[model samples]
Target: MSSDLVRFDATRLAGMIRAREVSPVEVVRAHLDRIEAVDSRINAIVTVAADALGAARAAEAAVLAGEDVGPLHGVPFTAKDSIDTAGVMTQRGSPIFRGRVPEADATSVARLKAAGAILLAKTNLPEFSYSTETDNLLTGRANNPWDLGRTPGGSSGGESAAIAAGMSPLGLGTDLAISVRGPAANTGIVGLKATHGRVPMTGIWPRVPRRFWHVGPMARSVRDVALAYSLLAGPDGEDGFSTAGLGVDAGVGREPSRPLRVGWLVEPGFGPIDPEVAATVQAAAEALRGVGCLVEPVRIPALERDDALEIFWRLHVMEVKPAFAEVTRGREGEMFAISRAMLAEPDTSVADFVRAEQAAERLRDGFADYFGGHDALLCPVLPIPAHAHGLSEFVINGRAVPATHSLSATVPLNVTGLPGLSIRFGTSRDGLPIGVQIVSGWWAESTVLHLASLLEATSPVRDLRPAI
Candidate 1:
């Protein structure tokens, strides 16, 4: 692959378009070609805009007439199915959401359009964005671009796969925990879960998770993620959760000149670590050292030896049950068996809900105090690399792990209401991608990206495309 053709970093694409070195039509054609060539094997995108060429022509015409194009002017992008796009069939990968189309776009989607981005397609997701593996009844399972046998990670799996396969320059992924970050680890890309409420969720279907959900960007480069984020963050009045007008800054371009005071936790706070996962994280730490960052092993005080991981799971089940119920009602739409099973066993009660909320408060407070001095917290995104879908449900090291809550490290960041960024570090011994997750304090997205950009600058994972 020629570097110029395959390189679709948001910043670079924006620059070339701004300089008129490339036409919007050419950019769209390149992406469309990639999708046609690679999406068949991965099944990453459920819908490709039929009008994409015409839209690109309009953008190209604007450029020719010397109209001021927006920052993302004519750049192609994708969003998970759960986010509504006008006139498009948003099959949230469920039979229920099958034909569901919103009259308007989600705020983030609107923002991207306002900034000159062209909406090209809706990526696949788990049923209702509920699971870790991207298998749903409507769109089928999304494969990892790296190894088709393994999963591309969950909920945002399609977005990760699509971006990794070079079908889109940027993607919008809502992280209800591991949905975004996990797939980035699995597919070798950057996925970010923005600070809660930083991006509006108004047009997002069944927004009951209310507290835990976050919408952010995924891309091949930290700068690309950061650029997309700058356009997506801030408030839209419709979402009560919008953190607009807070005088908060997006904080791009702030780089530390010297070694960063970084904290590392090898243990997944409490869960099991596949040996290869641990070594990959440690290797990333060593690489950071080479980049002038002081990496130190540190224990997170927020995580108790008890069931802190359980607390996140219970809370997730609580948030998930109602939303899942709303969509899968009457079995009206084609629902994934996983979603059907989850609905049948909706065991989360009000007591569990209260306890989960309380635990979350405690978790947030603990991290608030802990990050008072550190630049960022780096850890493994998953214990094991991408395994077959149901392996965790069986047994790992003879421990009866909850098949669904395998995303323990990632859920904590969501439950704690902090921003998290996942950067691909290296492949495990089995050749599955390994993700190093960097979590930051509240509204500290800029700091998180600063560290992520450094790692991207120093590591080889920045452009490790799966040779499909």
Candidate 2:
């Protein structure tokens, strides 16, 4: 029974709770036990509610009264600290925000709570959730469960670590660039960034122009990702850019039946992919074909000379600089290295920011045109697997690559305001995990999940638990 409960997915757990086969208390206890056993080694979590037992018991009593349980009943989940959690220390990994608490929940958190999912706790993230690596001045660093020496990934690194280590069944991750997919890629979990504004960003920090920022979900399976997404999606009234679309459930039981036409690319936006990544993508293509789906290697014309990085940087600077300037006003030493550099930029002028925003609008228009035909485009989530933590720079194919390009494929999707997700495609020869992104154009999460499900059915990454 213990093994069965441990192995149950969120969808299965919800069913068990609804059927009275499992109580919310039992589910929460099991997860707390798991977290207690693994969290110290990873430092993935900074807070845990000891009275979670009381909450779960109350949930069980509500269920016994025949209350209409939300779709995610009895599911235990965690979120990155970058997001605000009412009553919990929602520090964004900076001492500047140490012990800071919000008076209300983030819209995403409110939605999940409304869905009957337990908010177990919040996980760590990079300082201000800025850097791709998930270490900060507050909670130290998150170690990869697979290899303790390597980073799990970041700014959702703590969430990814917890999910990979089986400390939590589902986690909420935000992806401005690789916050969701990076840790997902490094930790061998599913990370999803729904279309820009698909989910409300009202409570996330530095909520500026709706350009590159996105809130996403990370879990062990694509089905879990979709389930979490459905609960968190739709408009919250304040984030005017958020979609008012109907949210669809895509759990294991609620999965689509048809195979999708998956158009994929082994090479990323600019050029050739890592040999291992290319091979894995090809293997996924073969697996898709075996499942009676038509998979083809296609070039995305939008991937060429897009100036995506420039647009993203310019827009981010314009928004973030002012927000930070208000607090750190004149305290240039208080900003992170990247934020400091961005603050120093005189190039992102009022004229330049306007033009960049217009360019971004054009990019979004082009993506909408491309997704008219393809269900989803499959590509490497990152150019390479998890590198050693704090490597300062990346050396891709003998070229000194910029640190920002470490997770290039997923970021451009953010810039385009499209929906993208990372799934564990394959493992490296050394056993490190490789991730692949299935990107669907703006607000088209259903297609992305459909293709991801098909791929998962074919090339399944088996339960390779990180040795915590």
Best model per lDDT: 1
Candidate 1 deviation (Cα RMSD): 2.3
lDDT of 1 by residue, 285-315 (tens): 8887787878898887777633556776677
lDDT of each: 0.80, 0.78
Candidate 2 lands at a TM-score of 0.92
**Candidate 1 ranges beyond 4 A from true positions:** 1-4, 244-246, 249-253, 257-259, 306-308, 392-400
**Candidate 2 lDDT, tens digit per residue, 33-106?**
88887788888987775456777888899899999889987688888887887877788887677789888889
Q: Backbone clashes in each candidate structure, one number apiece?
A: 4, 0
Candidate 2: 10-residue stretch with minimal lDDT: 247-256
- Lowest summed lDDT window (length 10), candidate 1: 244-253
